[model samples]
Target: MLKRTRKHIKQLKRSITQSLNTPGRPTLPQDELNIIERIRKAAAANNQNNITRTQAYFNFYQNHPEVHWALLAHLVSRNAGWNMTDLKGEYLPKLLTDQEQVDFFAFLERGNWLIFQDAYPQLLLYEESKKQKRPLFHLLDPLNISKFMKPFWENMWSNERKEELTIALIINEQQYIEKRVIHNTHYKNKVLDTIMFKLQDVLDFNHILIPYTTPLQQKTKLVGGTVHHFSSVEDRITLGKGLYDLLFSVQSRLTQTVKWAETNPHTGSRKDYWPDLFNDVKESTPGQVHELKSSPCSLQVKASRIYSPSLPSVWKDWEHNKAEPGDWYPNKKMFHFVKQPIKQLSGDIEKTYCETIEELEMAAFTKNTFFHKK
Candidate 1:
């Protein structure tokens, strides 16, 4: 173990030395700088909100289908939008104070924004490389992408190891946010370490749902796994791999899920997939407790649709502070994250999601009633 630790320390020292000696933005040619500017503008324009980011990912995937990670990011971004709108949806407003909701939204928004800003440039640079018929990922350094990604992108350009590239991106982005958001003192106190965040585990809320239509039946179904511990980077990377496998490893799922995304433009509402259970419009008056109309056993909606607002309806575009500067590539240990075996995933979680909603409604209703009585 001591020998291994020494080796790791040696690797870390080499990585830091390489990073410190890396060239800065001044070295890039004027033409490459122009391309980088265009890429930055494009990323900024699309990074406005969940709606724009989700659509951008889909469009990128359509154009460059070889980048499997683009599609995975699209699907995952959809879930992030749904979670954002959920803050103003039927149940959460009852349970959280206005400030708490705002903090939670900020937490979600920062991570979403950071990932897109970090990743989208890499995507666009690859597109440029294709146009020029030469590898241009060296421009990634000027764009402020993680040094960890440049080599992966270079290797991908040469070898086209799509899955490995995807896993590398997962590690890079997760580490990108670790210091800037997850462990930051402010977010730790305000969002991550709070009871409300803890309640996510109890409620099984950290799920990345991929909505896809089955081929034979043409039925829309939810297939995803839950990440119980969001604070752990390893768990999040594992979740990304599982989701990627579920979407791409299965031929039927890959084709159909793409079809589903093509058909349903994400409106940041659960209604996009299960319109029977969720509505983007506000159906009930504010602060009024309504009886739960959805049945967990039969998965039926008997009454008015639960309010699930679209992204724009509840939240505005966030102008994020510049991401803290640094690369997250620590050592060769990160390669293990890319090589970890993909777990066999069972993509059936619809019933459990319904039950979670029911529980949330009950909790909100009880809180509302107790407050009124007091």
Candidate 2:
């Protein structure tokens, strides 16, 4: 009986090991796991933002006892080409009322949008000062485009929708005030030039309109398990073009400003060694021989006859041009220029993505399914 019981335990252990070793699901990296953890935690909370809504489905799967299996089954079916029609008699539909499902889906769509935004971080504007020599500030996102479009997204999934959704892209510029004093540590000039560098008020706030429209008159089905519905190929392409133009416009302005800052000539203090002839000659008496000293003041003692006006042009130039300021030079090394997007340009950014949704759909379907092959 002891041997039989041991054999039974071994068989159970083998089964468990086999289940654990099942393939298909790739192991997530530590960073991705951390992101997922944050997502799950945020979704589990009563209050969740537009970004955490997709994760709430998983939260429900883990916490909701009776509705868990129903949600899982529906997810599997949807993945296998079954639309929302497969949700019949599911506990998920019963527990989460119709309106709640709509709300959840809306947040899910917004969450996907947030993911795109996070992928392309905001641009960093670096201050070109010694004291404040770092990323000064970031522009955009103050307009809050995602939050602004939330109200218009209500009828996005509706079968009957009329007007085109309008979105705004705003650019707000900040200027340096030149307030903080910069001490010239490298310059050897006698005069200590302390320049103040500070940031000033914001200006040149402008906005552009982006209109989003769908070509489909019928109710479009949700794809890829997300709340985002399907639009026409032409419509998607036009939206892509508009976003590209908008982003390029903003980027061009930033690039031009940075180039100007880097290439523009600015007069600054620089140090250079000069002979202490002025103080040395004044202090030394004619009777005693003046010994050369190299302490606080660097000086070379010579016969009083060497100070004659008949000296070479080189010596005369050096003597006359001593303790002068530096000439104008480009301020290229002062600041760092990084061309990154502040806010994720609205809609599907095809540049960062592998292919457009239209291309993806075309690839998925057979030539006969849509129409004659091109």
Candidate 3:
């Protein structure tokens, strides 16, 4: 596996080098330029928020079902939405200050937004390529996508290597965000390096959940894995690959998960998946003691639902700083993330999540009761 990954990386690096050495832009026909303009417009339009981005991915998957990563991205983007709304949700406001919540949301939103803008155009261009019935990936440079991806897209078109294409995209996007979000000095201090972010790690908030329904059951069942070290590009890639396998390896999972996404549009609320445990509508008054009637995975028969707000309710759209130029493919060490086998993960996170919430609530209650004198 290591040898094969090394060879692949060598090939990718050579392609990148060649792309760099040959720098002049190729002249495109007016029709292709028009197609590119339309793709850019579509990407920008859908890049508004988590809801739009999630819907865009699902819609793209519907049109190009062969691109398995679109479905995976849609589900993962749903989790991103849930995570964004979580800052304003019942427990987090107690833990994070208003500014801190804003900072954290910006972090998540920036990464989410960046990925959509970068990947959506690629998806649209691929659609155009299918329409043109030829490889049009040379347009990738014009789209401002990383040269690292051009080789993979070319290979995907010629060889029809779907899994490789998926993995390549996973690597490309993770690396894309590594410097722009994870390692950005501002975010490093404001969000990633903060104690609250560490608390998120300790509380297992990094778990990515994919909801699917079984043949006999209409209720949603989650099947997803967690990424332990979000800062590491390699770990994110590994998590992405694992998720891709989990989603596509099982036919029923793919079908049912798509159905769940289609039936429940993403509103940036956990209620989209588990309405019994979560509600977009606030049921309890803020800062008031409410009875905790929920267990690990469910609420009691009459328990009030927990508040999980929609994205727009809390955060307006943000215009990000222009992405810093340069690609993140610097070494062969990245290949370690490429071909490794990830252990299959089970979706038993409700108990862990509930326990984390309880722990956060306890800490908040203690802080409020003792630290803040009325």
Top candidate on TM-score is: 3
Residue-level lDDT tens digits of model 1 in 340-366: 577757877887887888888888888
From the highest lDDT down, the ranking of the candidates is 1, 3, 2
Residue-wise C-alpha lDDT for candidate 2, range 17-48, written one tens digit per residue: 44334453455567545544443344234223
Tens-place lDDT per residue, model 3, 1-374, is 11346677678668878987776789999987998899989998999888899999999999998788898899899999999998888777767788999999999999999999899999999999998898889899888898778887887787777887788788888888988999999999999999989988887779888888777868888778888888988778878988888888878778898888888888999988888777989998767533466563666467777788998998888887776787666554665555666556555665666776677667666656676423
Worst 10 residues of 1 by lDDT: 1-10
- Cα-based lDDT at residue 91, candidate 3: 75
How badly does each model clash, as a count of residue pairs? 0, 13, 0
lDDT of 1 at 332: 44
Candidate that beats the other on TM-score, 1 or 2, i.e. the better one: 1
* TM-score on alpha carbons, each prediction: 0.91, 0.17, 0.93
* lDDT, candidate 1, at 347: 79
Every candidate's CA RMSD:
4.2, 35.5, 2.4
Better of 2 and 3 by TM-score: 3
